[model samples]
Target: MSALPRPAHGPGSRYTARAATTRPRPARDGDVAALARRLTGRDLWLARMLHEHRVLTTHQIARLAYTSARSAQRRLRTLHEHAVLDSFRPLTASGSAPEHYTLGPVGAALLAAHAGLDPTALGWRPTTTGRIAYSPSLGHDLGVNELLTHLAARTHTASGSGLALWLSERSAARRWGDIIRPDAYAHWRDGDPLLPFFLEYDTGSQPPARVEAKLTGYAAFIAATGSRPALLLHTRTASRDQTLRRRLAAAARELDLQVATSSADFTTTDPWGPWWAPLEPTAHRTTLTGLAAHWPHLSPAAGLEPTDADTPLTLPVPPLPPDLGSGS
Candidate 1:
């Protein structure tokens, strides 16, 4: 008999290998039901987050959920072992990539059962982890999550400032795809002022004009909904940020939109710091909280209420997981 071809493994493989620590097990309905009994509220919250955001690295997950990296890693590995979360580490030219997590079959089943739906209704296929591992927009997705994770992590601090609402691209699309498609939608709370904004994490892959054209959609959204949330354009480079500011200035003014621009160079550590520059001719940058004061006319985006068409499973995932102190 002819020899069978060996399956590819490791870096650059078409089918990226799952973490070696992951023990493959069949996740039948009964098996998943048994696994569900062992899952914590945080675990279930993590599953919902993965389902919404598509993927998250270990660092991001730790920042969002755990007080320590070791704890997050240990718990995440346990989740992977029971097939409650799937993970794959990508090949990197430098050091190894952190394990990226997605919703596992068991996790999906748990969520579906909680929502009183069939497992197939969750839209998670067996190839989900592999697809996210090799996705071209992986970096872009990670960058978006990193910014929001930082915002959410603020809740762990003694400071009373943190993200109040965060809607992933999928959730945002479901809510407002008819008018505009923001990369993410967020309501940030720092003290009494709440800064509601639509985030556009630009990677500079598209032309400046192309980026500016998105403003037209926002204009329509505002006109249709009567909500004037600030538009935050986050670019990969200062140069691209400058390009977008200049390119979109006239259109933004003409549409009477509240817009702010920031670059990755300026927002590495503290995104809520004085990194945002309004579209107007101002050299002074302002904090995210300050933006609310700068543009007092801006209103919170509407349509966040659960609609008649929405199932419990389809609701927006909470920005932060349930409090551990509450026995979650």
Candidate 2:
């Protein structure tokens, strides 16, 4: 029998002990390629998702990618041990936090290859992740992800629906522009029309006016691209929702934008369902699917693909009209 290396017992033992025990075996390029080849399409998609979102908890990953936690646990462990994924458990006053996973070096390389981009351009580093694991904003970021991840999850079981695309704040900035990068950009198809929306999770910290001002950018972006995606705002409470709703209405009327407001304290079992209310105070709460009908400027679809090419676009002036005006 061989004696294992004596565990460190001094300061930083928490990280040191854990690191020593679960160190993943290094996988060569050939090994990584082979493993990557063997991965199901879903596995690759999950990897791409981690790259886009920065981090995801074990529970969130399960809900987003797998039918159950038991199954997710088994495959995630395999990916972790094979150096395809990395995770950390934050030290917390409540004992320990859930295992939050991100793309490993190998995983990042695979994703970069798939995207036809440089691995270094992905902006991922182990040290950065370590720092992020302890940041106070981690909880807020995860909560935003959790809300969107659940919507992605529902696509699997929900009828005639799909989670077509989800872009994080960073991705949104790169794909669109930072003039208005949402917490996430989600595009999906529900029944007849394709729905595209942006999500903003507010913790009641930023002043209401500051949040409302972002609508100006969104309006300008929509005018330029001919893409009209609703802006979804989820707040800390119904009271907060009401307060924002007033400002959202003013913005919508002033800038000719489309905004939906909601509270995190939901009464329904399904969080993705009908919790959203349009900026209008008289409007009834509606589901994500029902949101598009109320906004006349949105681009809708009868098929899987978006109908942007066929839809006429407009570049309206500052403070656009309720309708973009002069659309072909």
Best by lDDT: 1
Instruction: Indicate the TM-score of model 1.
Output: 0.92
Give the top-scoring candidate (TM-score): 1
**Model 2: per-residue Cα lDDT over 1-328, one tens digit each:** 0112322552222331243136665577678778877776666666666766777889887766665677778888877776677776655557766788877777877877776677777676655455455455676688788877777666557866756666677656655564676787776567775667888888888899999888888888877766777888888788988888876787687776678888778732355678888887588898777886677567521122334432111111111012212121
* lDDT tens readout by residue for model 1, 1-328: 1111223653235324447334555556578768888788899999999999999999999888887888888888888877788887766668778888888878888899899998888889876776677667888898999999898788788367889899999899999998889999999889889899999999999998888889999999999999889999999899998888889999999998889999899876578889999999864799988999988888888898888999987788887788544322
**Candidate 1 regions off by >4 Å?**
1-15, 20-29, 325-328
lDDT values of the candidates?
A: 0.84, 0.67
Query: What is the C-alpha local distance difference test score of candidate 1?
Result: 0.84
Q: What's every prediction's RMSD, in angstroms?
A: 3.6, 10.3
